[model samples]
Target: MLNTYAIMMVLTLIVITIVISLVTRKFNSSTANFYLAGRKVGMLTNSTAICGDYFSAASFLGVAAAVYASGVDGMWYAIGFGAAFVPVVLFLASPLRKFGEYTIPDFLFARFGRSHVARIIGVVMVQLICIFYLAPQMVGAGNTWNVLVGVGFLGMSPYQTGVVAVVIIMMFYVAVGGMKGTTLNQMIQFWVLFTAMFIVFALILINGIGSYASERVPLVNPATMTVEKLMAGEEGSRPYDQAQAVMSPEAFAEVEAAVQQGDPAASVNVVLPQTNKLHPERTMTFQEPGHRYDWLNQFSMVLALVLGTMGLPHIMNRYYTNPSGKSARLTTLWVLGFIGFFYIMSSVAGMGGRKYVSELSGSDPAIADLTVDGLLLKSDQIMPVLGKLLFGEFGLGYVAAGAFAAMFSTVGGLLIASAASWGHDIYENYVNPKAPEWKKVLVGKIAVVVMGLFSLLVGIGIPAIGLDKAYPSLIAMMVTWAFAISGGAFVPMLLCSIWWKRTTRNGAIAGMLVGGGGSILFIGLNILKETGVFPAGSFGAALGSLAFPSIFIIPLSFAVIVLVSLFGRQGQPPYVNSIWARIHGTDALSERVRLAMQEAESRGRA
Candidate 1:
């Protein structure tokens, strides 16, 4: 349908992944290597890997799409991603690494002497988040493929087929490579993503500089309400005349009847129904004829990003792979700098989408072109769509490569984390205590394949149920639930173990129950129907839209854990010396941090 660049880019990306994963096979042969790189990663590499993992299909596509669709207010997700890292840096990173556990539950079990509850919760959250994440990625893959190839399956679009293919590929890498494979692959993938972004920016600027079509702009002269002149004389659009302005006051006011109608364009149909209630500008047009800014709430939007990043499981697990607490902290800073730079590039491409394409290509094309099209490219496709428009073959190829790299990188991380939770946290500790190291690795590898297949099924099912449009949006919401639950349920215990010393085992369990359970339960009930469970409706239907139930659940969870811990006699955590070494080990990891990020790691670690 489009061109070969898209297909070629994807093929090259897949080939590289296979090559790299196969090479890293040595590292993945052992259970420890597959799961956590044998706990010996350097700061810079670890941090870069973390950023690669942290930035999911959502960051690559969703955030920019949100900004394009909703305007400046859409930056909340990025802000949340950055904000979530602060707590990790300030509190969690060091103690987590020092605890010397394979997963979060392992720490809970080691500290509290009852690992079952934490193990169950860890597995549950990992499974849920991974599935939520995997579905959108699969949909993204399919959508990309559909655009590159023909919609192939007996009337089913080619895009859907791509999703299945991508998932299968992901299963292969994840099952074979484990954490070692994933880490190396992700590091390389991030670089590809960055390079593709650069190409996209360059191509857009090339077209924009000598834009032969700038003259076709729909200029709105707020003062005269007439055709301000097309950009250097475009051919198609008709000049705004008095007669036309009077009828559609929203877009254009009629010059002839407007004297009688009295600025009739003020109450145009395009404006939202309740625009007057919020702002002084009573004009109801969707695009304020002459103005550039869109009305948006910045406060809560940033709040989400701040909180969401901390809860992200893939990023969190990266800290545990470091050799020392200081290394984990240093890696986080590197991730921040790395991720932020790309965000700047992403925004530039988003603007390019608005300028070059003039329409969103989310699920359909030709519906709304140009301004609305940017909104249509499901959150992940925003950058790629813009690339296709500006660079044509070369640009499209670059973007396809970047997108796959991002997708694979994210999935690879998630699979490893999931494996770590199930294989290391549950299987080794509880299911088969006597299992050998090699055997555990085998089981973990098997778990990756099983989990991946399950993820694929869920991804395909989302579209079948007609909620494909909502997948990206749902992932962000689910992440919030993850963050709120983790922050509320576990943060208190983690803090107590390191600083409070009075936190008791009983309190940790109660808090986990109250915080984790409460948030999960609330989030679960809130999405009951939208998940495609028996198409019901009415006034009661409004309840499901109250989707982010975690808003309420998070605070409740924190309060429960703190109170429970306080009620029981706080006892000192057993791993205090090791935790202290990790949490405050500037000297211990000076050598490790020096290894990867010799210069940059020094200040942040200190």
Candidate 2:
């Protein structure tokens, strides 16, 4: 049955979107107004909007799921996500806004003496990053819908229902409201999500009514009819003791069915319920690191997330919506504060989930009913599962609303970013340079529809290919791939162009080709190996780490760019002094505007 409260929250979201659309409708007539909201977004609103766009399902659900499943190592994602802003504030935020471009391609082309090569490269990279990122958002939306509604519409599967519904709704808002409506919606959604998350954390962690990772869980030996403490998995090995702890007979049969169908991860490790390795007398705590990530994995994951934030097109484009460079800097500072608090809540949610599933489920008959044959079959479903267990349908409704917020806000920003890349950067520049403003806006709307449909298709198909098993884990992995690609392909070149005077167009192109191409290739190989296209062995294990390629690909990109620039005879980009002065100077808004205009006019002459 559909939850009435969930339906009401979703309807409320629709109504708010409609009101914002009506209010912002007048601002959509011009390409400039449509894309950047007339560059009038304030610091607090912009920061909240950015958080709405940045958090996504990955941060909201995936981080919590990671912590629930893996314990202390899961906190690494929260740490990396929060720390990502440090570089954004110190290096990119103000300079990027001062540079003043509609898109990443726009900035790169203007910075590199209006090189068409740079613009085309930027469009390609932006499309790659946005498209890859878009798929996971769609998948997460579908996952949320399954939990919220628990039923399909018009014979469509639950996953398909989610993908179609969210895509169509977001496409309408993005197309009609453009950036103005999307920005306002994002700001509103951020608060809704933040409030929902805080409530869950307060109830679960502060109340101490829920189980924590550090607490000992009770497990029953089906054969012996005896109860014992359940131990946590330690570093360097899987806990066979847990596998040996059998579920109900129905669950045991299901495990056997899964193993028979080629799912080794689900296969049981013992013939009977066992507890020797579990140390039934002791309790396990999640106070240490290295539960899932080794030192190398930790370094690579952190590097990708940090460097990747700089290159993400959807995020970089937000700076352009700021009225001035100073506004952009302030926005970044606020974003840092918001993101830190949000991640703390995410950690709490994860711990709460761990506590709920492990320690609390067996104590209460009502809570026990929420489990699948006495165990959490899929860890990714931890949040929704907990919602129903702890607070019934009302809690599920609130969580569903928050999940929708996470999905819709990020998807809205991404579609706009994709539309701008295709319509303004590619079509306006290459296909119809003389197109009028109205025609350009029309093209942007069309691009939004096209991109939304494409992502929706990918989201629906992901489950058929067996990639949707662990709800948030698969989503997180795909998102990390997008991050890795962005970090390798764009971060090195972008940072060099802004900070180093020696960066040449040729060098940037070389770096993008090597870094971007290599990252994609590595991801493809990793996918192939994962899907059993490559036999299991050393080669497959090596390909495993390649899935997170920033550690290696980023360094390689830096080297390629530096080496190519050193050998190239290209002169310094025109008006380098003025560009640097504008980037680093602390001038009044009007003075900054004058300098920006002068720089643009110089680029026009060149």
Candidate 3:
């Protein structure tokens, strides 16, 4: 049966989101209002909105899931995510806001001497990053729906239904309300999801079910498990010994049946020993470093996330909405605090899920079927499943709503960013330079619809391509791919163009192609290797094992920019000094506006 309370909560959130969009439609008369919320949002409001944009399914569900599945390694996702903003605050925030552009492409084009090539390249990077980031959120939506609603509609599977429903909802709100509507909705959505996380954490403490210290306790004793090994003559093998040790007899029977039938594709829940990837001689445990990454990848993953935040188009786009450069910096400071607390709570909740879900699975056959030796089959389902186990239907409802809110707020920002790139960056600049304000806004809405449909297709394709089965935590893994691409492509270019006076147009262009293109090439190979397209022990597999490419690609990109600028005939623009002054100078316009507003208020009082 559908949890009526949970469904009601989800529907209420959806209703409110759409209503806010409809009400804000009136404010979107110009391109500025439609894309940047008229560039007048206050510091606190924009800070919360930025948090909403930043915390996608990866932050909400995937971080906790990663912890539940990978232990010590999983905590890295939370740390990387929270630490990403440090670079943003120190380097990018104030300068980007002061320079004052509507989109990343706009910044690149102007900073690189109005080069059309730079603008086009930036647009491509923006769309690629947004779509990559958006797909995982869709996956989270589908998985959450499958667990919460447990049924299909309109001949679609529950996962498909969930993806379709969210896409349709996002398309409507983003098209109708524009940035103003998205901003208001995001601010509210941030608090809702944050509160839900806090409540779950509080409940775990109050009930005395688990504590932060409980993470040291393994859900299944590693000693009771056997290491997986290939049989001498068998074509395919099963961990029958491991399954028998941990699973109930009834569950073991199904494994036996699959093995007897020679089903090579069949799998059952089994506890197998973890290998120490970082240190080959060491024994692996829940508190160790080698559950997922080797030593090389541990550093790679952290670099990707830290540098990636500075490159994210959607997140960077929000800086333009700030009224002043100083306000933008303050906004980032608040964002660090909000997301820091949220990530800590999410980590605690992951530890709690490890204890409670394993204990409850034994008595509940339904829960047992979703687990393998007490560990969930899909880690992304941990939050909703744990909620239900702890507080019945009400907990399920609240968590399900929070999951949707996470997707909604992030996806809303993405759609707006995509629209701005196409509408303002491309259409207004090249396609129809003289187009009226109404026509420009219309094209932006059209772009939103197009991007929404594209995201839906990517969501459905993830499972079709076998990606869902390739990673232990699919949402988090896919998001890291997006981050790698962003960091490699944009961060190098942004740092050079903003801070380096010798950065020529050709240099920026070459760096972007190298950084962005190389990242995509490596990520594509990683996917092929994971999906069994490249067989084990092959050179292809070895090359594809570097999952996070940021560490390598980022430095190469910087080198390309510097070498090209120093040698190339296309030197820095003649107006480079003026551009530099604009970027580093104080915000005189903001000060004048503040004074004007105060004077108007004083006159009215007299």
Candidate 4:
């Protein structure tokens, strides 16, 4: 009964979001406004909008759930996601804006002579990111629906209905609103997301969450029934096959002593000389298990975050919305500050949710304890579920409203960005050079419909995609695919276009092809064949052994770009003084930026 209010609240929020998006179309009706918010968005407003778009289902729900599930390893997701922006600030943002291309491909095409190659790279990368991104958000929407509204359509469950509604709503706004409307919606949605998250987390402190003693998740495998399995393995069996055998003399002696003394616990816990981390490798269980890391995991995660941000097309495109390179940089600084605060709050909220939610501990324990329905559930479902648990139906409703807004705002940005890739970068720029203004607009609108439908299709299967009950881990992997492909493929092109005047057209093409193709093939043939789509034998298993979306790809990409660039002799960057003047600037930038943008708008192909 109470759930109806929660559902209503979310639907209301979705309606509000659509109305707001439709209204923002007033800024400017040209391609620029539709594609880049007319390139005149204020630093503060734009920064907030970026946060709305940047903090996907993963950031909001994934991080907290991870921490709740894993000891120290789970936090890595947040670190990597947040810190990745540092690279964006240092190398990509301002220059990207100044280059003034609508999409990543547009920049590549204009900067290099190979428009076709750029178009191909742009399409592949965008398609991958969009799929990875769209699926999880749909999954999250399903979870939200089940919790807030009850699952019962043709026995279709609330989760399925939520996925349908959310995707439809996302497609609706993206098709109707375009870029200008999307940005405005994003800015508003981010604030609501932050505020709702804050209220729920703050309530946690009042209820005493942070100060609660931290404890390890109870180790138990009801299947097969044994304390050995319960404490250290799976299905009531020992996790290791001696798996505890000490190879070194020093380690062997220690193990022998512990075993002789009949101290199995000590024997299990004993450290081997060559081994790192007191805990040996085991299936990392977070949200039921996987994607685990150590305390420094945050540092590694942050490394990915800062470095990866240098390449994300959606985030990078925001810079171009500003009038000048200077405005672009300033906008990033603003984003960092806003995002930082929100992230800190996210951590607090997660910790709080962990303490308060009993059902998350699999409230129905007699059910065999094998499934999430048996003993506590995955952590990603913790946030929205907790809001309902603690805040009553009304509180759940508020959080759901925020969630709906977050989903719509982000989809709007993605749709607009996708539309631009098709409209400006590929169709208008290459296929139909003579394509008229109305044609470009029509093309963009059509692309939105196509992409939106595809996203809906992807969302349907996401429920079955995860390795465990906590679906966010899969969602995180999906989002990282976009980041990795972008960071690995586009960052080189983006930076080289701006800084290295000597980068040749041939070098750019090589880097794009090699980097993009290598990553795709590696993921498809080796990784995704098992994890994403199909299971493999030993060879495929070996490919799946490595941590995904990791730094492994970074070196290969950068090496290819530099090696290829050095081999060639063309496209050298401009002189230092000229480039410096273009990049650096001063305070009170709004006026100067606006004036510069107006001049560019006045002169452009429009």
Give TM per candidate: 0.77, 0.87, 0.93, 0.80
Better of 2 and 4 by lDDT: 2
* Candidate 3, 228-261: lDDT as tens digits: 2311234433345544555667656755665576
Best-to-worst order by lDDT is: 3, 2, 4, 1
lDDT score for residue 431 of model 4 = 84
Please give the TM-score that candidate 1 achieves against the real structure: 0.77
Which residue runs of candidate 4 sit more than 4 Å off their true CA positions? 26-28, 152-157, 210-278, 281-291, 294-302, 359-375, 464-472, 522-537, 570-606
What's the CA RMSD for each of the models? 10.1, 5.7, 5.5, 8.5
In model 2, which range of ten residues has the least summed lDDT? Answer: 221-230
Decide which is better by TM-score, 1 or 2: 2
- Quality of model 1 by C-alpha lDDT: 0.60
lDDT for each residue of candidate 1 in 219-242, tens digit (9 for 90 to 100): 211121222321113433323332
Give per-residue CA lDDT, model 2, range 426-536, as digits (tens): 989889988998999999999999999999888888887666542326666788788888998899988998898888889998888888888898888777766556776
lDDT of 4: 0.62
Q: Highest TM-score: which candidate?
A: 3
**Which window of 10 residues has the lowest lDDT sum in candidate 3?**
222-231
- Give lDDT: candidate 4, residue 103: 77
